[model samples]
Target: MTKKKQNIIFLLVVLLFTVVLIFIPTGFENPSLHKNTERVKAVITAVNNSDLQNHGIVTTGTQNLKINILAGMHKGDTISATNVLMGQKRIDKIFAIGDKVLAIVKTDNQKILTARAEDYYRISIEWILLAVFALFLIGFAGITGFKALLSFIFTALTLWKILLPLILKGFSPIVSAFAIIVLCTTVIIILINGFSKKGLVALVGSISGVGITCCLALLFAHFFRIPGTVQDFSETLLYVGYTHLDLPSIFIACIFIAAAGAVMDVAMDISAAQNEIIDHNPSITTKALIRSGFNVAYPVIGTMTTTLLFAYSGSFMFVFMVFMAKGTPLNIIVNTNYVAAEILRTLVGSFGLVLVAPITAIVGGFIYVRNY
Candidate 1:
């Protein structure tokens, strides 16, 4: 088949998969839970904070709001809504008059009963931010940026539509995650690099590195005695009746899944570099090509080695701050599951990054240089 024909077919398959995912039912969101509630956009006309009380920096109690509905069946209706505070600043919101809010209006037979100021109506701003990002990407990188956006959407849909659903359906989290990674890795590399040696080498090397990371995570997690409950909200899943889940396995899956992107990046870098070298100098021996690939990889691996640490540490910075504020001992902190889990994530992810470089280089030497 022609290369152009292959690209057309690949895009069509991706589009079909995306459409299917959009309409796929995971059986979890059976809207009966919120059948009587309708989300509406509204402006807070007035806020009565008389019932609210201050306890330290956190506020607890409720603010009664008079909201003028701007959309939905309740349009033009003025209703009273409650914004409750639970003394947790992180999850709490304080709204002033004239602020736009998302109002959850409860109704039976189209008659309004109660309303809640659920949160700010920030969806508009979120869409605007996304539009800005899309514009910048396409404007700068043109066709390649557009392809990257499609891959980004595909990855997100696969995680939400396929990966999480399978895990929730009692499938093994480790297997479910790996399958999604492979699916994502294949489509993304192929879509960007097309049906060629570059894509093939990158895909193979990326998966290999991810596999190594998964093994290390599971093996070290056992030695580290990570109960998996250490992951944020993992225990909450058990409380909410997903007792069938193996949290430790899911935690292990998360380590490699997080690392897979970095692995793919390194692999693609080496593969693309080797392919360019071989194209420029066809007589370049596989050994010389391998040396050149390694030279290209060394600088990338240096920067990438600390990339996971920065990303993982940023997510848990507040937790680290809390520990510091409490003056926790370094020995105790290191032994704690929180720090241990972060250690596992950083090290395993970095290991995958390091492994992918040489794997891609060695694989690329034979595949691209020798046309194997």
Candidate 2:
């Protein structure tokens, strides 16, 4: 089949697969939480903050709000709602008049009983941002940009539909994560680069890097005594009746998944560079192309290895602040469970990133030059 025809056919198949994934049931639900509760978009008509106390960033007590349901069975109905603040600056919010909110209302016999403000109504704004992004992407890169957007959607859906559900269903998290990541990487590369030798080269190299990262995470996480509970909400999940979830294995899966993007970047870099070299000099030997791939990879890997550091450090900055604020010793801080986990995350991920460069270069050498 023609290359363009092949790409079109593949795209249709993938689009169908994504549609199916969207409707597949996750098979898990919070029965206690959603019982008899319906959410509605509301505009706060009035607020009574007389019962609330403010201490700079931290606020305690409650905001009693009058909200008008916007688009539901109770549309045009104004109801009293409570917005509670627990003094946790991070998660607590104080609502005010004229603010759009999502209020979960309890109903009996088609009459609203009570409403609780869940969060700000940002879904509309979120869509606006996404629309702008999609326009700019397609405007700049045309078909390639559209394909990139499709790949992005595929990745998000795979994680939400496949990975999360499988793990929640008590599947082996490490294997589930790896299988999902590999499938994502393959589809993403194929979508962006087409189904060709270069795409295959990239996929192999990326999966190789992911494998290395997973193994290293398994080893070093154990060595560093990093606990899976270091991840946020892990304890909450266990307490919420997923007590059998393998937290440590999930942590290992997380390590590779985090690194997989950078690994793919490196692999694609080498594959694309090698592809260009082979295209320009079709007679180039495999040995010369390998060297060319390595040359391109040298600078790319250097920056990428550091990118992993900055990314992890930025994510872990809150932990750093907490330790420094408490005047914790550097030694004690580094040995802390969460801190150590971050360290293991960065190092193992970087190792995979570094390794993928050579792996991609070698793979590309054989794949690209074999055509000559």
Candidate 3:
């Protein structure tokens, strides 16, 4: 097999091994068991006909359901679930009279199954969407697409199965974020570019970018005195026994991790630009090639810093609107920890974007001159 194919196979093996080793110990297979409640397979019978379901969505407007439960203790039970109109008008799901669905039967402590149609229908839809995306990727990029898909899956599974758990276990949030970032960077870059000078340049550039962002995040986080609780769901986490987790540090870490992708893009762009210059003019001096990288990075910096700014600002549009409506004073708005946190996030990420150019230029210059 060719070098690229070999590298792809090796990455797949490593990804599979990492996932199995990291997730299996977490007992992710078992569903949570709640007191006085057990999940059962149930089918929908009717919609909105009784007080028991006044709060339920009317799927079929009180029509009788024809779907039957297909599994568990209620394998053959037939029930009706309502297709309530959500009235928000944006919701597209409209349940029909004969649609099969899984219904949750709330027993005093154990749930019996009622309907299975909705669950099956949702699963079918999910599969269909997955198939469409897979086909699109395969059609567009072929083997590269396949490798990208694997890398995407591995990154997702790693975050879900390993990183979150580690954070919840009271591990240092910065340490966990860095560790996950390293793992993700390695897998994603190698899967896409293989183990070559180009990949090494991208890795080095991305890491340097992340490190710069992390430091900026820390310094500004302290300067702004933004509390970690500015993050939504952070308090929820603390209530769940992760009180030891430092929210501010985690927030800082997340700034870098979030910017990592953009930084990698900048790195790869410069690296590729430098590579093409070398390939076309193999005798170009290293200094001249480095200047070429700087030229590419300059335009990239302008666009990407704005990209990060808008991305961060978009999330706070509602908050800004609320402050405006309330006629909140500028000082108050600026002093709010939540607003300050976002400011830090934006500036820190922008700093990373700014730093990526120099790092990538240097690394790409060396790689281009040495490799080509």
Candidate 4:
């Protein structure tokens, strides 16, 4: 077969494999009953933000609602459920006082109450915004932007639909995370560069970098004496009967998953730069191509180091400030799980960042340049 046809076949296989992975059963022990209890259509009565007496960011917002219990045993009961907004920092507005919404209802001992936030669809605005941005990107960058958007969607879907489900199903979180890293890297690289030698080189480099990142996260997470419970929402899952879950391994998995995108970005950048050097100077020796990789990797390394640092630091700035205000010692503060996790994340990812240069340089130089 011709090179073009071979590339096409390779992409089809990868796409097919990704699709299959979505249907793979995750063996989660606890299965929730597939049931919707009751429907409560409630209109928000008033919306106001009030300050909590002793809390920093906590606010007391009340949702006064007129509820029509439309389904289940509570059918025809026109009751009012008042929801108090605790200081939980959710992505949505957590029910404004006057925002009309629906609720899931459950009854016990003749008391009918709201069960869940069935009407959390208020955050559809974020989805709408993302859709508009995707369209704008497609319009501006044309085909390249469209491929980028697809890569973006695949990244999000694989994390949510594949990885999360597998983890909840009691699958080995490390293995699942590794599989996701490979799948995401392959999808994104091939999508961006097509199925050429450049894409292959990028795929190898990214995989190697992710391997290094995983090893570092495992070693350091163990060394630092941090527990898996450091990860947010872990305890909550345990309370909900997912206590059999292996959380430390999952925590380790999260480290690389978070770093995978940045590592892939670095690997592709260096590999592409080396490829350009070879194309421009076809006679350029492998040594020169390797040097070109170094040239590209250095700036990328510096920028990415800060990129990871700031990305992590921004989220924890408030916690840092709280510690500082309380006169907590730097050593103790740094040793806290919250602070230590960021340190591990930044350092392990940086190690991968450091290692990608040589991997991409050597791989791109030898593979694309026809050196044995």
Candidate 5:
């Protein structure tokens, strides 16, 4: 079959898969009581905050708001809303008159009992931002950018629809994650480089890196004695009747999944470099092509290894600051479970990046130079 027809078929399959995922139930819908709670777009018509005073501080406090619902069953209805302030800056919001917001109206037997301000209605703005991003991506990279966007959407759906559901349904997290990573790597490489020698080299190298990372993560996580409870919400999952869930294995799986992107990147770099070399010098031997791949990967490996360090450390900057402020000892800070987890994640992921480069180089050598 022609390559053009193959590309068209691949895109159609991806689109169909995306549509199927869209309809797949996540089993996290609201209960029957919440069924009467309608999220509606509302405009604040009035705000009365005269009775809001907390210890002589005029901070965020309760405000009675008159809201006009613009959508849902109670369209064109003006209802009273209570904006409760919890004194937490992140969750609290003070609404001004004429401000548009999302208000949750609770009803019993068709009678509105309470209306609460949930959040600002920002979906339009969010879509505008997304549109700008898509426009810029397509404008810059053209068809490649379009393919990348499709891959991005596909990866997101696969994780949310397939991987998460499987894990929640009691599947082995490590195996599930590995399978998803392999699927993502294959689809993404093919989407970008087509189903050719470059894609094959990249897929093999990426899977190899993921395998090595997974094994190393499992081995080191066991020896480090860091309980899976170190992960946020892991203990909560057990407490909430999911006692059979293997958190450690899930944590190990997360390590490779986190590194998969960088590993795939390194593999693609080596593969693309080898392809370029082969195209330029058709007579290049396997040994010379391998050397060329290695040359291209050297600088990339250095920066990509540090890339994992920066990415992992960025999330823990606040923790690091807290430790420093408390004057914690180096050994204590390093041995802390949270700190140890971050260390393991960065190091093991960097190891994957380091391994994928040479692995890809070797694979690319065999694929690209074999023909010559």
Candidate 6:
């Protein structure tokens, strides 16, 4: 078949696969054993502060809230809900009349026992924000932007549906993560650059860089002696009955997965530059094209290395501030497990960025320069 026909077929296959993924269940639904609990949206009709009181060192209070259920089986029914305040501002919320909120209703033997206020109803706003993002993405980039959005959706579904479920099923985290990264890199690069020499070079370079980063992460993590529990919620996973997981392996997997995006970026940069060089001078030698790719990659590597540092450090800015406030020594802070983990993450990812340039340049030279 012709190239145009092949493109159309590829697009159709992608769309079909995406649709199927959308409906596939990840087996994590309704894993909660609490069958009597139901979450519903409700609007506060009235608030009664009759139970408000101070009890010695702590203030114990309850707000009697009249609410009309907006959803679920009891929709349109008005019920009495209790908002408990334990004097902790972080967990306590005071509901006002006419406010929409989420509530957990407990029922036993088909009789409603009680309802508790959970939080403010914010799903509407979340959907609105998502819509705005989709609109702007498609509006700006047109067809390519639409494909990028699809790739985003595909990546999310693959992670949430396939990757997470596989890990939960006791698959090796390192192997699973590597497979997902390769899949994502292939689809994303092909979507952006099409099924050409450019995409192939980028894919090869990206996978090679990711492989190197993964190996380095494992090596450094082992030598550094940082446990997987250094990551947030990692310990929680063990508490929740996933004690079989290898936390250190998972943490090592995350390091390279985080760096995969930057690796792909460097690969694409080199590939695109090489493609352009070949287009301009069809007779250019492989050596000359490789040098051109290096020239394009050097400046990009500088900013990308710092980009990884900033991206990783920005998340822990508050932690850094707290350490400084307590007059902690820089050596102590750097040696901490959490700090060391971030250091590994940033440096390993930067290494991927640095290495992907030369790898992509070499691959691009072989692919783009046909006379080599």
* TM accuracy, model 5: 0.91
After TM-score superposition, the amount by which residue 349's alpha carbon in candidate 2 deviates from its true location, in angstroms, is: 0.4
The deviation in Å at residue 330 for candidate 2 is 1.5
- What is the lDDT ranking, best to worst? 1, 2, 6, 5, 4, 3
The residue pairs found clashing in candidate 2 are none
Query: How large an RMSD does model 5 have?
Result: 2.5
Off by over 4 Å in 2: 30-35, 54-58
Q: TM-score, each model?
A: 0.97, 0.96, 0.80, 0.81, 0.91, 0.91
Off by over 4 Å in 4: 1-63, 67-79, 85-97, 100-102, 105-121
Clashing pairs in 6: none
User: How much does candidate 2 score in TM-score?
Assistant: 0.96
Model 6 off-target regions past 4 Å?
Answer: 31-36, 48-64, 83-98, 108-111
Tens digits of lDDT, candidate 1, 218-237: 88989998887988799899
RMSD of each: 1.3, 1.7, 5.2, 4.6, 2.5, 2.6
lDDT of 4 by residue, 254-284 (tens): 8888888888888898888877877788888
Q: Which candidate tops TM-score?
A: 1
Model 3 stretches astray by more than 4 angstroms: 1-6, 18-45, 49-76, 80-103, 106-127, 370-372
Q: What order do you get sorting by TM-score, best first? A: 1, 2, 6, 5, 4, 3
Q: What is the lDDT, from 0 to 100, of the residue 167 in candidate 1?
A: 92
Judged by lDDT against the true structure, how good is candidate 4? 0.76
* Colliding pairs, model 5: none
Local accuracy by lDDT, each model: 0.91, 0.90, 0.74, 0.76, 0.89, 0.89
Weakest ten-residue segment in model 6 by summed lDDT: 3-12
Residues 1-372, model 3: lDDT tens digits: 788787968877966766685557654343444443434444444443332233344332232345466665557756544444433334424445455554544444335433223342455567799889988997899988987877777887788788878876778888888889888888888888887778888888998888888878878778888778888888998897777888888788788888888888888888878878888999998788888899999999989989888998898999999999999999999888898888788888888989988889988887768643
